[model samples]
Target: MVSVGDDAPDFTAPLADGDVGSFTLSEHLEEAPIVLAFFPAAFTGTCTTEMCTFRDQMANFEDVGATVYGISIDTPFTLNEFREQNELNFGLLSDTNREVIDAYDISMDFADLGVRNVAKRAVFVVDGSGTVTYTWVSDDPGVEPDYDEVAEAADAASE
Candidate 1:
């Protein structure tokens, strides 16, 4: 994973914007605060609840002037289905290639972890300056982040 003081590694990947499209971290976060919440995959129970919580609290983040988006190894097609099914209001980035997740060093170890090329669940709060201020990682797959901590930190950092 990128470090606390290091620049947040930027990458462009396919996203579910109506259909499968491309989006860049630097571009999306150019002039706004960005929150990239990484999950393991789509349609999984814990992942769904975690993302849905973000959906419900999205306005809070926006109200504090931060743009929130979710990132995962799932394809845009699956992401589209997830968004439509769950009514997610933000972009669900497809890191199927694992480029972005790999850059963040959040990709799971296939041999030891038993899941080949899955992303570790994480949350990163990047300020408008493209610096990551807060980073949260779940110890295991089933755990959900404390969104309140991240949200509050993002709000404070954005200011």
Candidate 2:
């Protein structure tokens, strides 16, 4: 996993931004800090709750000049539906190929559940300089990150 103070891995992926736009990590870092929330899948209970938490606290993140994005192995089409259904204001990035997932070393195999290469529940805060300022990887997929800590990291990165 990428640690704090390490340069965030750069990647561009299709974003479920209403119109199928793309998000480049480095490009976004040039503008503001970024909060990347990697989840296993869309429409799952835990994923839904975690994303909604981010949505509800978006203002706090925005106040710190940070952009929030949820990354998953799901396709953009499915993610767009999920975003609309949940009224998510942030972007849901499609890491369908699992390239970014692998790069971040957050992939999980669930052979017993018949799933593979899904992302572990994780959060990463990247500053304007593309350095990872914060990271949280949940051992259980059902667990969520600390929202307050994430917000504080974003606030600190903005300064």
| lDDT winner | 2
Residue range 62-152, candidate 2, lDDT tens digits: 8988899999999999999999999999999999999999989999987899999999999999988899999999879989999999999
Write out the backbone clash pairs for model 2: none
Candidate 1 lDDT, 63-135, residue by residue in tens? 8888888999888999999999999998889998899888998877546757787788899888887888889
Q: Compare the candidates by TM-score and give the number of the best one.
A: 2
TM-score of 1: 0.93
RMSD of each: 1.7, 0.8
lDDT of 1 at 100: 89
How well does candidate 1 score on lDDT at residue 24? 84
TM-score of each: 0.93, 0.97
Runs in model 2 deviating more than 4 A are none
Query: Local distance difference test, per candidate?
Result: 0.86, 0.93
Output the worst ten-in-a-row residue range by lDDT, candidate 1.
Answer: 107-116
